[model samples]
Target: MMRQRILVVDDEPQIQRFLRPALDAAGFDVETAATAAEAKRLAATRAPDLIVLDLGLPDGDGKTVIETVRAFSSVPIIVLSARDQEIEKIAALDLGADDYVEKPFGIGELLARIRVALRHAEPAGPLPGPEAFGPVVLDRDRRTVTRDDRLIHLTPKEYDLFVLLADNAGRVVTHGTALQRLWGPAHKDDAQYLRVLVGQLRAKLGGEAASLIINEAGVGYRLVTS
Candidate 1:
């Protein structure tokens, strides 16, 4: 069987030192790049199965790398960065990153998220048609969403959260469940992540459609279907 390839892009030598071995031990064929320029070049030539990207690089911002790679590829990207600000996380996710891990992270958690991302990336069997909740519509198969016949752009995480709630429309999706489904078990207690995603989802949804996602307060959220 061909080993799964992973491209690790980070400028920190210490980070490169540890992640390469950890990923290798976890059975990935690992490659490393220390700069955004290098990462873009390797991504073109290496065609890695997934990319572990860092936000700060010597040559340019990691978001640029994401935009560049997303232009030509849908390869899963998991960002590893020291920026723990919610804005940074939201920005990265909105820019096409599949996942984000804050620095001072546990290798185990990162590995688990990697598994979730890779599994989610696989081609699945046929899915049901677009689901409608009022004006918002989500086409699961195409992974596209529309509101009032116009397209609505959602980040990967936002889409996941939307789908989860959409799948259980009119019912409460506890914060823990939503978090785990979108961010893995390790993030079950990280309600802030879900909150930020929901906030962004609401912003793009706009107006009354934004209110479709109801906050349950210290409990979870509900996608009001009616």
Candidate 2:
């Protein structure tokens, strides 16, 4: 069986050393780079299945690397950083990272996050048809959303949130789950971000579609099809 390739981008030699062996033991083919430039080069040339990136690179900010790689590839990226600030975490997610891990994190948790990202990135065989509630139709395969046959534009974050609800249509998807899925483990307690996104989705998917999303106070939101 072939192994999934993972590129580790961090300026700290100690981190690179620790991650390479651990990830190798975890069944991944790991490659390491110390600078953003090298990271981008390896990403393009090596075509890694996932990336474990550090925010502070020697040559440039890791966010820039995320933006640049996002322009050409959708390879799952899990950021490894020391900065645990909510703004920093949100910024990386908004920019296109698949997940984020704060420094001094557990290896077990980091591995779990990597697994989740890889699972989401994998192409599934023959998914069910788009889920519809009223005029709003969500096509998970294409990641395209439409209402009444008219395309509704949503930012990456908004589209992600919408898909999360639509995936569990009629069932409540808790705020913590949504935040963790879209943002990362670090932002699970940040319900305000979820609130803003739900509001934006409601506005974009106006009228009946807006009503389709029912927010349960202090709990979560559910997509109502019936």
Query: Model 2: per-residue lDDT, tens digit, 147-209?
Result: 999999999999988878766554446667789999999998998899999999999999877
**Worst-scoring 10-residue span by lDDT in model 1:** 167-176
* lDDT of the candidates, in the order given: 0.84, 0.85
Candidate 2 colliding pairs, count: 0
TM-score of each: 0.60, 0.62
> What are the runs in model 1 whose C-alpha is more than 4 Å off?
128-226
lDDT of 1: 0.84
